[model samples]
Target chain A: MNKKYNLAVVGTNFIVPRFIDAAERSGYFHLHSIVSRKTQSGLCFRSANGYDSDVVIHENIADMLNDDKVDVVYLASPNAIHFPQAAACIKAGKHVIVEKPMTSNTRELLSLIALAKANNVLLMDAMKSLLCPNFSILVDNLSRVGRIRQCTSTYSKISSRYQGYLDGNNPNTFNRMLSNGSVMDLGVYCIHPFVHLFGSPEQVHAYADLLDSGVDAAGIVILKYPQFHVNITHSKTCATTNSSEIQGEDGTIVIDNISTLTSLKFVDKKGEETEISAPQDPNSIFYIAQHLGETISSGLKESAVNTHALSTKVLTVLDEVRRQTGVRFPADDR
Target chain B: MNKKYNLAVVGTNFIVPRFIDAAERSGYFHLHSIVSRKTQSGLCFRSANGYDSDVVIHENIADMLNDDKVDVVYLASPNAIHFPQAAACIKAGKHVIVEKPMTSNTRELLSLIALAKANNVLLMDAMKSLLCPNFSILVDNLSRVGRIRQCTSTYSKISSRYQGYLDGNNPNTFNRMLSNGSVMDLGVYCIHPFVHLFGSPEQVHAYADLLDSGVDAAGIVILKYPQFHVNITHSKTCATTNSSEIQGEDGTIVIDNISTLTSLKFVDKKGEETEISAPQDPNSIFYIAQHLGETISSGLKESAVNTHALSTKVLTVLDEVRRQTGVRFPADDR
Candidate 1:
């Protein structure tokens, strides 16, 4: 029988609910604890989930990591705190699964990688999209389209929070000091597929229009490779068709959305079109959840799904773009 | 009666036919002479069009421009020859119309502009797409869609000649020394709209995968503006869907083809879609043809349609992309 793996859930806002629900469905995993800053909020969450009254709720992360009940640490802190918390967890010799925009800077990510190596533990950037089987199928079928000439991918969502900003309230997401912006939040989807398809870009250029709060409300990035080019657009202040197209010499592949990877259409040079659809797992987040379980159960140090090298490259590109556009966060100065 | 604008046609290639046809269609213009390096080709072209047989065909451009009958010169030379030829025409007090990839460099274009000012004659880059009615519609309606966050444009075509080159033929289009490649040939279309809309980028970072001949077979250029970003991709060694998307905060405008501006669709948030179909002009080439007539009739010394400043900016970007990617053209040495 396979060893059972348990996970300590971290952060309890926005995307965490989906993560928890997905973990529940994956038979290989068990949720051991939930941690958050506010004790009342953490207690409310634990009670709602029928967790024990004495469930570990750590206001201080260091205390949580030292607890014998916890086997792995997941960091879902704000963009600025991700680095310090992740680095601390790695130092504590605990496996870590951090949410996307993994670390604010590439240099910090490198340090964490070194620490993970020394501690003989696992560290993964939860770029969940790359782990999806549908994405794997798309990667396998890229050659079928022929030589890729150009690519355009957009992942844009209109933020209702902008209305608050306009009406005189600051949502931390649009605040530049927190490293909160459209590119960091939404463009990760755009960058993942390009980096996965083509290696690192030979050169990168960014054009970004900033919001009043000095954050990149929206932007476009161009990544040029040896045989072709990729164009990435992301915005929180705006909305888009939210589709991606890869144009090749012989045919073109169109995907409806960045996540889910549901609709795929292949159009040929002669203008004939073919549609291909496949059923996804009951929960779309199953891929990453399963990977975490297997890695922990087997006592493996790392995951092939999210490599340190790939994460570093993505961070490097992200940092370069921000530097070029003058998008400085409080963490950047530090 | 309108002023009769005398024009000289230079080169007898693919574009020359369209120039002559458009010139003939304009009642305000007269085809005074046609010049070519080979007397036989010049005479053949003239006779085919039933041009006045007594019209002189000169091998030397200086002598041809000295003739009182020539009020303007049309340059459709090979990519490498544009700078010197356009400069000579400007020096001779003749208005000039030059084809795309204006002068291979910003410095050359600036020199031509200086000569045109000294001689007091019109100098146009003949960027027909900027003058098209469809583009005008796009520019006018841009603000109605809300704040534009990103613009992604692609222009590509399947060149049989490139196929022949891959099969071991030395086509001039792929020749690095001639400043002939996809960015100059097709990517110009990609940049023109961006320049027309947002002005010049503060900084440009471009990367290209060079062909064997040291020309950029395909490339991506990112133009960074203060508010938004523009991503452009162009290729000649392959084919593409050849469409563009102008995305804003509330909705996105999809254009089927930038080259012809054929189809458009407006898609908003909540997945609601509206089809926007404007009637297509029978001749997509009319913009340049009509602009030439209007410029001549107005006795304008220079045209804002394809002005010298705009040409300089576009060439500056092209040169930068080439410089970064190590694409060297013969004209760079000059």
Candidate 2:
């Protein structure tokens, strides 16, 4: 139980509180600092989340990276800023954990991976679902289902800020300039698990309902594999059943809440039900933080579970889906 | 009620028994004749359904169509035989009810509509789902949900005979030569209701897992409209949840089985449930039979509920999906 790393978190959005909670729960990582553009809001957020009064608070990335005590930086900034922010952390010799979508495009992600290797610092995508203990249980039970035939995953919830957008507000989640859209914001949850379960698809096809803001409000992506096919539907404009199903020749697996993966049920041909449950922390970020801490302690440059290769494959597929659906972001030009 | 129209059935497949039962329940249609390549199977089918012994049995379509007493013909033949058989019945001045995926392509369906008009005989595509009394209730309750945002319909069931195909027996349901595939055989149930609920989509995009038989074993079609989007997924290789959902700004409508539409539940944003139930006849085909008989008695050349126009629209979308998926039929050349 060598829990002795100093971790700093970037971004003050809704995810900052969860990341702080994850760090505190890991028991191996200390919340050494936080970087936010508004120092007042940063101080308020730190106190609200019960961070120690002595925790360093910085208003910019440079100031936080200069802190020699910070060994790991968890980046949860906007989509367009992920590459530059993570590159800066790695260049400063700090391990990094990025949010769901590592970067806006595959080229940026590839370059970041190269830079991390050059700097000899670990770079990992904080895809919490893959890091959960239950996900390994699912992977272990895949053989019981026999030959896979089809998979359908859906993640849709009407955004609370959607009404504001409809009333003519420019929220970051719906802004193309920020590299934000339904695919990047919501569909990433589906793509990560898909890539983790099955490797890169042979072909990718997608269709979307693009909003006037130049971002997709809803979309469906079809991933064609050699033996099986996957269909992922996601939206920010409406809520759905939010259930995922994988059908095989001998049995089927039904997963509720693919993002959290709280419940899994397997049904065989004889209609026998088997419930597989695992330890689920109230805060999902705790699992990813624990895994990241352990991997860093062992001197690993990437996660064995949320592998760099898997993140790259997911980003590549998402890039293609965005291109096919005409969801262009400012970062795409670069 | 006329209760006197003479009805003739073509094809001795499993659906013929259901058509016989529906006619018996309609009370307006009498089973006067049956057409089959082998009259022995037709006799057995008639006897199994308890049809009167005096019912005429014909070995050819011409003989049944020429019978002056036959007022309507129900063509339940394979996918490729629908157009020619329905056209012949129309030319013989008998009303016709053709099973779904009425023909292999839209061109044949359009020609049938025109011929039925010229002959002054009622022509209809027997899509029982559209004619179900519960369907009308759903249509009437659409406004309660507010402006529509998205709809998802799935009708996937592993065909009972799929094992035969897997074992190297080419059943008609899985045979490309007979113009039979998952989309044509099972997807029509989803497409028909989609068109009935929302008119023809502006664009249709599809991806499929084509079997070695040159037909799709499973596939998904995305229908894009101006205000809303629809996703229809159908498969013959496996069974699914078999549910349909329509999401709107204020509420959602869910149907247990889109094919039979036995249960409908509406949920609002406040988590209130409204169970809307309608008259659900045990025999679904009875609704279509009753509608067709009444429309013909009124001297209408097409059904208002299952209109020739609506049928053509659905087939046109189906044709586009087939073209995208490369599920070609011999009749497609014509």
Candidate 3:
């Protein structure tokens, strides 16, 4: 029999409901609790989702972590508080899945990894791209393109909150204090695939257009591998069709919406295209939920797909990019 | 009546025949003379292209220029010799059209500009992209995409000469002494359109994958404008569909092939794509030939479309790219 673990979720953002629904539908987990700064919002989220009366709502993260019934906590709060919230969950001996830009920087991520091991709890970032079935297929079919020379991956869309920011409001997505910026919120989606597919580049150079709030509005990063180059362009101030291409010696692979792995096709030397086939889910978050659920069921310390090592390397690159772009968060010093 | 100028061509490469056909078809110029290192090749080129027997063939460049009937000289020689050949034409008091990467460096370009003035003749580089009818449409439609935040333009084709280079032969295209590299050849196509569209960028950064011959096999260049970023990725080592995009605050412009401007469309915030329509020619080179003939007939000393000032800015940026990539030619020193 497949054991369904009890899952607690933090925050009440759009992503939170999606995560909760995916987690329960994967048949490996159920919504066990909710944590939010506002008690009313947590209750509203649980009621709206029809999670029943047993789903506990905690206004305090510490009080939420004290619940032994919660086997794993998913952190989806603002970019700033992921570290402290995940650390409290880990110290309480519950497995934790922190959302992307896993923590403020490499320092906080490393600390969480250590604390998770000390408390004998699993730790993983919600890096769902790698867990998606299409990622493996994309990597497997890369040879069809011959010796790769370059990959251009991009994800850029104006945030719903951007208009407010332009109207002289300080949204958390553009707040320097919250460790929120384009590189963190959007660029990470572009970076992880390169790291997963090509490994760490020999050199990383980045140029960013910073908002007046001292956060990146948009940026271009050039990652120079020994044999090729990978360019990552991400923005919260602009939008694109977001198609990407991988150039190779004999052919090219065209990927539609790389962040989603929407559709992929390879054009050979003769310019004939071969459609790459792979299984895809409407909500990719479900794959990560299943992977984490399976990991917790097997008593594993971390997810194999979203490994600690991968997160560490990604965060290190993120730190280097921030250094190059001159974006430092108050959380980084913490 | 518009005067059809008498034109002479030096070298008998593939582009030479194409230029001859376009120049004549445009009804603005007729082949007047031919000069080549080998007399037979020049004679063969004229014969194969079906030029009249009166189209004079000269083994010596000096002999070709001495023909008073030859009003303008079109240089189609190896890149390294463009400087010397163009200078000789300008010194001989004849209008001249040199191919792209006008000279090895900015110094040579500036010198030729001054020399053309002193010699009282028209001087121009055959930069075809700006002359193409579609380019004007692209520039004019920029507002539909809103304020541009980024542009990724690439032109990479695995050259037929690459196999020879891999088979341990030094093709002039990969030869260091010939001022030949991917940037000077293929990358030039990607750079010119950006300079024409956005003017010059404030900063340039580049990375190259160099061949054993000490020339770039492939490269990525970052051009940082004050408000946006432009990325140019070009290679002779690899091939791609070579589609590109201009990302803007409200929309994106998708280009099928930037080097050719084969197709373009604007995707708005609602994701509705509007196909951008413009005049396109099967042989796009005809546009440049017609413009050059018209410029000479108008008694202009230089091209307004492919201005010397634009060429200067482009060459300056190219020099910076080479500096960053550590690609230098023996011709640059000369």
| TM-score of structure candidate 2 | 0.94
Query: Which pairs clash in the backbone of model 1?
Result: A209-B227, A209-B228, A238-B249, B122-B301
lDDT of 2 by residue, A146-243 (tens): 66777888887778778888889988889999899888998889888988777898999888888899999888888889877888888888767637
Could you tell which candidate, 2 or 3, scores higher by lDDT? Answer: 3
What DockQ was computed for model 2? 0.45
Per-residue CA lDDT of candidate 1, range A178-271, in tens? Answer: 7788888888778877887788888777767888888888887777776767878788877765368787777777776776677677777666
- lDDT per residue, candidate 1, B1-334, as tens digits? 6677787878888778777667667665678877889888889888886888876787768878889889888898878888888888888888888988878878788888888888888888877777666776676667656777777777866666777777778787887767788888888888876787778888776767677888877777777776666777777755554358787766777777776677677777555777674675556556676788788778787786677777888898888888887888778888
Question: Which docking category, incorrect, acceptable, medium or high, applies to candidate 2?
Answer: acceptable
Q: Give the Å error, residue A326, model 2.
A: 2.0
| List of clashing residue pairs for candidate 2 | A3-A28
Query: What DockQ score does model 1 reach against the true complex?
Result: 0.35
Q: Give me the runs in candidate 3 sitting further than 4 Å from their true place.
A: none
Candidate 2 local Cα displacement, residue A81, angstroms:
1.5
Best by TM-score: 3
TM-score of each: 0.81, 0.94, 0.97
Ordered by lDDT, highest first, the candidates read 3, 2, 1
Scored by Cα lDDT, where does model 3 land? Answer: 0.86
Q: What is the lDDT of residue B47 in candidate 3?
A: 86
What does the lDDT read for residue B210 in candidate 1? 75
